[model samples]
Target: MKLYHHPLSGHSHRVHLFLSLVGVQHELVEVDLVNGSHKKPEFLALNRFGQVPVLADGGTIISDSNAILVYVAKKLKLTDWLPESPAGAAEVQKWLSVAAGQIAYGPAAARLNTVFNASFRADEVIARAHDILAVIEGVLAERTFITGSTPTIADVALYSYVARAPEGNVDLQGYTKVRAWLKRIEALSGFVEFRKTPVGIAD
Candidate 1:
């Protein structure tokens, strides 16, 4: 398998982290986003949206970070990563939705504004970050993982951006539960750390 990605991309990091956790032997193909390589025709052919973190497994191709997580978990028959029960599946999907919506526009977008100079209202994105963190903190106060006791794709989907929220100037200081949750994911076996951007003007 080959993962086309950018190291600093949280979306890319989530997929890479899951593959590592599952001990899936794969190759990393870095997309040169700095030079607009993702916008090129060849790369666009892989994902018409021209995004990083596209997975190529033989003839199968998967895009979107959460989608990639679901695909890999199902393919590996990792029931722990994705539950079979309808209720459990719904719980996991709920957080995955938060990862795509709140997490994306909040922490992820804030990080993009700072780290990549992407135009976004920092205050607004940071506010959204806190709003979602509050909800996550409340849920995590009584559980070990986002969905339940065992880790799931929901945890993976939310990990990278939340872990690096500080880089976006969205402080994680107040959410004790969220901080603890991040540490738990870090301590997991086979866990791979996301590359930290050096503190710069973004700080």
Candidate 2:
């Protein structure tokens, strides 16, 4: 498996972390995101969206971070990371949706604004980050991990951006439970660290 990713991209880190957690032997293909490598025709062939974190497994090409997580979990038959039951699957999907939606527009967007100089209203995105973090804090207060006691693809989906939320000026200090939840995920075997960007609150 070859993972084409950029170090500063949270979306890429999400997939990288999951691959490590699952103890997969893979090659890391660091895409030259800063030099427009991802935008080149050759790269666009892998993903028309021209995004980092594309997984190339044999002849199969998987794009999108969440989709990659699903593919890896299913391919590995890691039912513990991705439940088989309908309810369990639905529960995991719900948080994956949040990772794609809220987590994207909130913490990830804000981090992009700071680290990559992407144009985004800092105040707006930071506030959005807090709103979602509060909800997560509440959810985590009642349980050990998202969706239930055991960690799932849902947790992997949410981990990178949330753990690095401070780089977006989205303070984690107020969300005690969320902070603890991040620590719990960190302690998991085969865990890999997301490369930090020294910006905003993280500075």
Candidate 3:
């Protein structure tokens, strides 16, 4: 397997962290988003969406971070990650939704604004992010991981971006439950962290 990733991209970070946590060994192929490599013809042909974290699993090419999580987990028979039963499966999908929604809008969007000079209105986005953060804080106060006591794809799905939320000017300072949850995820075995620039996913 080969993973195409950008160091600063939290979406890519989710895939990287999941692979490491589950001890899935793969060759890392860095995609230099900074240099417009993802937008090039070759990459565009591989993934019409031109997104980071395009995973090549033998002859199969999978794009999108959450999609990669499902594919890899299912391929490896990681039933715990994707689950098999109805409630357990729905629980997994629930937090994946959070990954694409609140977590994306909060930490991911904020990271873009700070690091990429992204066109979003900063204050508004941050406030909306904080509102979501408050809900997460309340939810986390009652549980260790997002889905339940043990870590699942839900935890792995949202960990990277939210773990690095401060970079986006979203405060983790006031959310004690969130802070505790961060520590919980980090304490897990084989948890590789997200990297930034000139490393991890280099050109």
Candidate 4:
């Protein structure tokens, strides 16, 4: 398997982290986002969206980070990573939606502003980050993982951006439960961390 990714991208990091956790032997092909490599014709063939983190598993090509996570988990029969029951699947999907929506516009977007100099309202995005973190802190106070005791794709989905929220100037100082939850995920075997950038709060 080959993973086309950019180091600073949380979306790419989540998939890379999952692949490592599952012991999937794969090669990393770094996309030169700094030089418009992702927008070029060759890379566009893999993903019309011209995004990093496209997975090529022999003849099968998968785009989108969450979609890649689902495909790999299903193909590897990782029942714990992704439950099959209706209730469990629904719970996981709920968090995945949050990751794509609130998390994306919040912490992830904020990070993009600082790390890549993308245009985004830091005040608004940081506010959204705190709002979602408050909800997650409350949810995690009652359980070990986002959905339940065991970590799920939901956890993987939320991990990267939240872990690096500080880089977005979205402080993790107040949410004790959320901080602990991040540590728990880090303690997992074969865990790979998102590359830290000295920006935002660090600046």
* TM-score for each candidate, following the candidate numbering: 0.97, 0.98, 0.94, 0.98
For lDDT, candidate 1 versus 3, the one ahead is 1
Model 3, residue 51: what's the lDDT? 88
Poorest 10 consecutive residues by lDDT, candidate 3 = 194-203
For model 1, what is the C-alpha lDDT against the true structure? 0.93
Q: Give candidate 2 regions above 4 Å deviation.
A: none
**Cα lDDT for residue 49, candidate 1:** 94
lDDT of 3 by residue, 1-203 (tens): 89999878888888998999899998889998888999999999889998888999889999999999999999999987778889999988988998898878776787788778797787877887788889889999888888788888888888887777777777778889988998888888998877653211111
True lDDT of residue 57, candidate 4: 99
Which lDDT tens digits does candidate 4 get at residues 1-203? 99999999999999999999989999999999999999999999999999988999999999999999999999999989999999998999999999999999999999999999989998999999999999999999999999999999999999999999999999998999999999999999999989998887842
> lDDT tens string, model 2, 1-203?
99999988899999999999989999999999989999999999999999988999999999999999999999999999999999999999999999999999999998989899989999899899999999999999899999899999999999999998888888899899998999999999999999976688842
lDDT of 3: 0.84
Task: Assess the local accuracy of residue 45 in candidate 3 as a C-alpha lDDT between 0 and 100.
Answer: 80
The model with the greatest lDDT is 4
> Scored by Cα lDDT, where does model 2 land?
0.94
Cα lDDT, model 2, residue 24: 97
* Alpha-carbon deviation at 35 in model 3, angstroms: 1.7
